[model samples]
Target: MALRHECIQRASTIGSNLKDGGPRRRWAAMLVLTSALAAPGLAFAQDDGALDIVVTAQKRSERLQEVPIAITALSADALDNAGATNFSGVVNMTPTLNSVPYVTNSDTLVLTMRGQGEADADKITKDGSVGIYVDGFHRSRAQGALFDLADVERVEVLRGPQGTLYGRNTTGGAVNIISKKPSGELGGKAQLTYGNRDYVRLLTSLDLPAWNNLSAKFSFLYSEKDGYVKNIGPSNDYGELGNLAGRVALRWDAGTGFVADYQFDKGRTRSTPPYYVNPSLVGVVPGYSDDPYQTYRPVDLPVSKTDYDNHGLTLSWDASDLVTLKSLTGYRELKAHSFTDLTVALGLPTFPYNIDQERRLKNREFTQEFQLVGHSGDGRLEYTIGLFYLDERGSNALFQNLTLPFGMGTVVTDRRVRATSESKAAFAQLTWTPPVLDDRLELTFGGRYTDDKKTAARSIVVNGFAVETDIRNRQTFNRFNPAFTANMKWTQDLTTYAKFSTGYRAGGSSEGGGDFTLTYGPEKITSYEVGLKSQWLDSHLLFNLAAYHNKIKGLQIDIPVDAFDPSIVDTQNIGSGTIQGLEVELIARPARDVSLTASYALVDTKVDTLLVPVGSAFDPAVNPGSPFAVGQNIADRFVIPFASRNTLTLSGDATFLRVGDNSFSAHADFRYQSGFYGAAGAGPAVPGREFYHAPSRETVNGRITWARALEGGSEMRVSLWGQNIFDTRNKQFIIAQGDTINGFVSQAAPYSEPATYGVELGFKF
Candidate 1:
């Protein structure tokens, strides 16, 4: 009680100083607040007296609060509360992340963190700036980018450069997905849902604990929804989706504190293609709707199916009190097939054809890490070291039919390509606390080095004539990413910290080549950050704020072929950029039944040297007899696409008592994003065209749940939810081009879904 009063007093003083301050007074206010927040360590401790969030940010188990870094941790409960069915839904709750999907393929997810992400997903060879890791294993294929979270434990989004501890493929940040381990308890659940548009879904899980030291859990889900577009040819227009998933785990806790576990997960999904409309004609057609874009001709002909499977084993041995060893081995495989009709080619009657594409990706990764953590000189210094390896292979095939400009038309073309990549690395990190000043201050540092190799093959066949090419490339670069962090506790309710870190991403080759073989290089970044975590007002409210500045150099950017056709465009190690931002998160529970959570992020990202392709008329002189005849410089035509500069999110949760041992709860959330461009245009002479000019938009969602107690500690829940309640019609994608005349023309139009409402029933045993 005394400590709480002291914290409130300090907070009051700091607030007063802010109201009457010049530059000096502002600094003093910050110091006072930091001191007050850092002093209440005991009161802020978790129930078990351990760190609230267990993180591997430093390659070891450290409390999220103790790690002097900017990050967001979402527990499994949070995911269930938000109704996150896929990766895109996950980003809705995480305001710092953004995902852009293509109209032709909505499953091809492009993720960006803090405005630093790949601008295009069409390229097959370019690696994403933000890396994704599952059970400590990195995923390298873009085609298999989305992963289902059937039984996930937690998700960690570590912002800024994580190259030192994570090693390679993480320029902007890293996403760590930790799946739920096998439980010793025997319990499971079943759920069923129904919504508008003929939407139906079912989910079930079962747990078996008959075997000693071994437990197995299985989960399956199936869902179907009507298409959004009107199929003029099929007479029926409704998109559909179906999914199935399963998982099993085995764990053994041997004497001497040794633990070993193995887990496997398999998932598959078949979905209808996204709806497309001509953006130039949107709003012009009265009674024309975004829902109709979801419709496609020959419905059975245009469909996409994906299969994913992964298995992993982890071994941890607490050899002694001072040293420990951990090893994780995993293998993953993914395959996808997609078919789409050429609606954009409707005007070309000579050859109205469709496209068929297939992709197969496989990866096998093995990582072994050994760390020696012990208290030296009365628990003053701590350290850890580790080694890692990864191997990935990808294969793709494309089939297209070209119609002659006249009735004579019809030519078939097929292209196949394959690529393989391997990487190895070593890393180490350490922290030193002098035990001086009553253990109020701490310091830390870390670094890592990596070597990588890649090879690719391509085959093209036309009129039974075959063309083949093979290329091999290798690169070995040593990077020493280090970090320094300091934390001081001046009071019982607050803590202040500052951190500086370095990160890196490895380079590879362009899988396909037309004219030139593009070579990509590594990208590096350095970030500096400071923040304060505090709780006051008798622990009724909590607020955390952070400010960061990142200087990115040698960033890798993909140059599209339209800018320079016939030329194999690859990633280039060019230009530098800056990202500065402030993040604030508040959680308050004024009453036992009411909770408020609000988060805001202000980000500013800019490119120093903007070098982009501009697609314009072909130039006959440059390439005689080639289709491209007009000449135009398409460089600096448009700002990089899919980057929203501003974003905001707010949510609230309320619970109330109902009739007969029953309870009801309500949840509401809102999300907003600024406008951004969709394509790249040629320079001055050929003003780059704009597609899907996504203006600022906002969405609101809400849900209500009612629960009743059953026999033997069991419970049943019924819930109702609605998404996009406003029924806002928005464009998700737009592809455009021009003909001989300089008039606007659209190649394809894709619109997002409208409002959706549904009811869910769940029972827990």
Candidate 2:
């Protein structure tokens, strides 16, 4: 009570001083607040007396509360309680994050943060603005981004530009997945789950005890399920899954303050994509249905398969109490193939009107990083310096065939492309804290220098005839990114910070049907942010707030080519834009056995001078007498698509019963998102293009669990979980074909899952 009272009094004094004078006086008042927070007697209030979260977002372990960056960390237990088993589940729990599906294939997933993302995610030559790292290794290709989490320790989502410390291509922040390390104890766990639609999942893990300072861990998982959508075609179901994955890790304490760890992982996934349906156009055509989730076709079922392997090694040496050295090396490979029915179950009369497509992608990458960390004897100054290098290679092949209105007409295309890239960088960061001003303030400075280069070759054939040959291109880019931060403690449990940072994304040549060698420039972003993190009532309550503004230059926009060919498109450095947003998170434990949390985000985006491609092949709105001409500016016609204006999430958990050795708990979550565009052009402004408008929606998920303690410190748990409890109508994708010279029709695909219920049993020893 006394600490609370002192905090209240200090806040009152600070508020008065802030209002007493002009800009300079206000600054002085803030400094005074910092001093009050740093007072010796009040420092103890910062301790929550509960669970503490540690993260390595800055290349060093530190308390999450003390870190100046905006981050959300979730433990393994929290994830299990939320019923999250994959990457898609993470977005459902985080308000500022969104996942967009790739229309061409099911294996690829596009991620967006704070209204910043790339639209051409399906292209093999393009890379995501947001970076994904697992066990200190980067995942470069989006095609293989979503993998099952077997033994994940924690997941941290960092908001804003993290380019300076994390290196290049992090303009929209990063996601870090840290795996549980091999412990020096003997233990293991196993679980089985059964759900609706005949869904079955199994997972097992074993940890071997230490022997001569060496320990090992192994994990495996298998899952299979039936599709939610009922197909009236030759196949009985659409959107099915059968996957298998495993991992092995070994850790050795070499003695003398030195250690080494190595890990290997492999996975195979086979699945069927969601059946496509256009409810709006269903009744307009003779053979289409109005039900969004129901489809009819006579063709065979399409299937997609992906196989991947990952290898990583890390070595560390704690030379002294004040300095450490670390090295990380990794290699990853992926091969994926997908077949899709572009007709989307359309039962058109003409054979050529229906289309079928297939895609094959192979990728491999190698990365290495070295770091040196040091701190002053007084524990006031800290610094880190590192070097990074990456080499990658990939290939993409696409095949399409169409039968024309007449039996005499046939069209086909086969395209093969191969690419190679390399990147090198050097980075350094330092934070200083002086004894003056009560040691309440810290200033940080960081920067990175990167050099990137890429080369690609392409071959194309039309109707078994060579149309384009011997096409090749090469490009190189370099950038210097910097970051600055000012952090201050305003009270025993309150801290505030201001930061400015910059990030960059490499450029590449166009590998499209229209023009294979056309090139685009790199993309960059400069971001400014201010945030506050606080805990009150003896650490029982927590609140965090962050607001940011970002300036984007050389935005890359993919534009379709001749209407005669819809499969080909070109990427262009269209224009500049701005993204601004606010995020708030709150957690409270009003009672000993109950906890509640909520998050909200507001995002706004604008592109001042966007350019659109114009031509008979490009525009469905254009006819012979159309007034529009090629190269005309269409800045006002485009909107930042796939971005919701407002997103909110509310969750709660409560312990209902407790016996001598048994306990029961209930958990629930509700999420809501405002309506936004599902694709680039929203309306009829861009002819021959598809315009999809996504309606606002809400969903609810709930879970109940019971745990019992066994002998020898072992335990057992059982849980019942259900998502979309209300059977909500939420569509995942939409495609509307406008008036086109090729007599193109409309198509759309809705989300397949609906009101799924499941049960799980697990044991740990």
Candidate 3:
């Protein structure tokens, strides 16, 4: 069959037929959409074993080779092959991509792509540089993402600016997670795992038999582990992990060209922050060891706890042969209480007990979207039109204790804050394959217009005295993002394309603690890309390459509002920059069950313009945000965090040792990254503070599995896997803090996770 329609609807699917003219245009779109509804959905192609992979990169089901973009799709089997059970593990070595877990191992994620990402994901009011979508529902806050990937169908990572199809906050790109739906059958799978450091994990899934066109599914996971670093002090070990989560899904097929899917997920997580060990204090502190895996236990700290719930419902109807109407509704909420200890005070002695830091955080968001997908009767033109709305509410109560010098009394500060936003947008994209040039050329144009209204309110009380009753501010921003693309097919297996796109990251009120209320505007990105997709060796070898350049405007620079306390931030539009990158990926299959893959990305970031914030002369008594008295521009001195100059991934998989109904397979992978900086050194404040540098590092992971085919359409498998098998010790972060009150500097550098090996047993029927 030729590529004749936007969707691959089965002929058995019965849909409405209509007339011509504008009516013809409308009916054509419906026909193309109803074709897709004949089945529940199309699964994106995974890594390895397949040349022509299916993808929904363009909102419509299409071949991955035909999509004119840079994307890496991984299916469930691919994940299992790589022994990936967490979000960070799934994208560990993706080209042009960087994924980092939060300091406290919470549910938040910092995803940097093509050298663009959010530096401070801890701030609740700020938006991430990349966009994350789950089953057609956009996630507003990055704080409550899926810390563990369970029962996921596939994960697609799209590089470069993707604003035309996805909305704002996609200056870098997007990560689309498509989960498994109810299969309308009685089947299930379960796995149990045990690893080093006393780790224990369990995962299970169940599918109920279909009844009256209704299907239901359930999944649960429990994971816990001891900290990698030993705690020698009064508190528990550092970097501990404990998590429990559950998922429920329901699908209703009306059999009248309509489908409804409802999904709900809840997770409870508890963990301690990564143990901080500073080289400067390695020997000076009492019982401080230079080894990254050992540390003098903290004096007084509390374990972090977080609970979140996410729910989404999708309703779709084949209104006619020319158009399909779809609606998505999503609701997510998070409640968390955490404590952070920024000091390593092993030598200091205090008689009084006081609280160091505490936070009670909460956030909730609701989103609704309506979409119309269609194509022309001749299948020459395809289009998508959508309207989106999102409302978010966030609240936080912060408290901290500071001890004065010379045995003085402790001072306590309290602040309560609330932030909310309401956003509305309309977006459209159209693709036309003209009759000229044998219908091999495709031209596309897309655009989105968005309006956002945001509000921030803060109330402060100092030692039982109300300083600021309530300081509230509201701001509104509007913008239009556009994209253009030209793609061509030179042969059945060769395609090339070029694209230009734009996106923006929303901004809001800055938490400046003084009398003034500060706010910043949205930051924007302009990106250009060229890509190639080709196949050779008679479908045994596949190659994909892409190059892109991105320019950023109104860079949102976050600075510490308080010198002693680094958690509070004052955001500003202080700089602009440009980023260019190149990505190359290749996969080769020498036999029916053997594959080799290589993916590499090279990126460079440069500042176009960076200005010093206008401020009064630095007076230690009056000003704390920064000490720079405005002078010459220092654009080149600015820092970019979580960006590696060079990244490479190499992997191989083979299935051998075959028996009558059993076979063994082995998988191995190596990941390498050049030097990358952590957070910018205190936002250009303290003396000699700039980029928090971390040296280059590499890791190796491997897994071996044995599978047996059973009667009655069932299978059983056992796998042994190990991550960081070499136990390489490498620093992953360097957070610098200027302790002016203590008259010294504190450096917090934490190393990557140690080696871990586990065995998993799974069965499906």
The lDDT of each candidate is: 0.60, 0.73, 0.72
Q: Tens digits of per-residue lDDT for model 2 on 150-183?
A: 7888888898887667744578878888899999
- Residues 643-664, candidate 1: write the lDDT tens digits: 6666655555566667886999
TM-score of 1: 0.83
Q: What is the lDDT of candidate 1?
A: 0.60
TM-score of 2: 0.89
Per-prediction TM-score: 0.83, 0.89, 0.88
Off by over 4 Å in 1: 1-63, 122-124, 235-239, 281-300, 345-377, 402-411, 462-468, 471-478, 563-570, 610-640, 658-660, 679-692, 736-749
Pick the lDDT winner: 2
Clashing pairs in model 2, backbone N/Cα/C closer than 3 A: 352-403, 352-404, 563-617, 620-687, 620-688, 621-687
Off by over 4 Å in 2: 1-51, 283-285, 344-352, 406-408, 562-566, 611-633, 683-690, 739-747
**What order do you get sorting by lDDT, best first?**
2, 3, 1
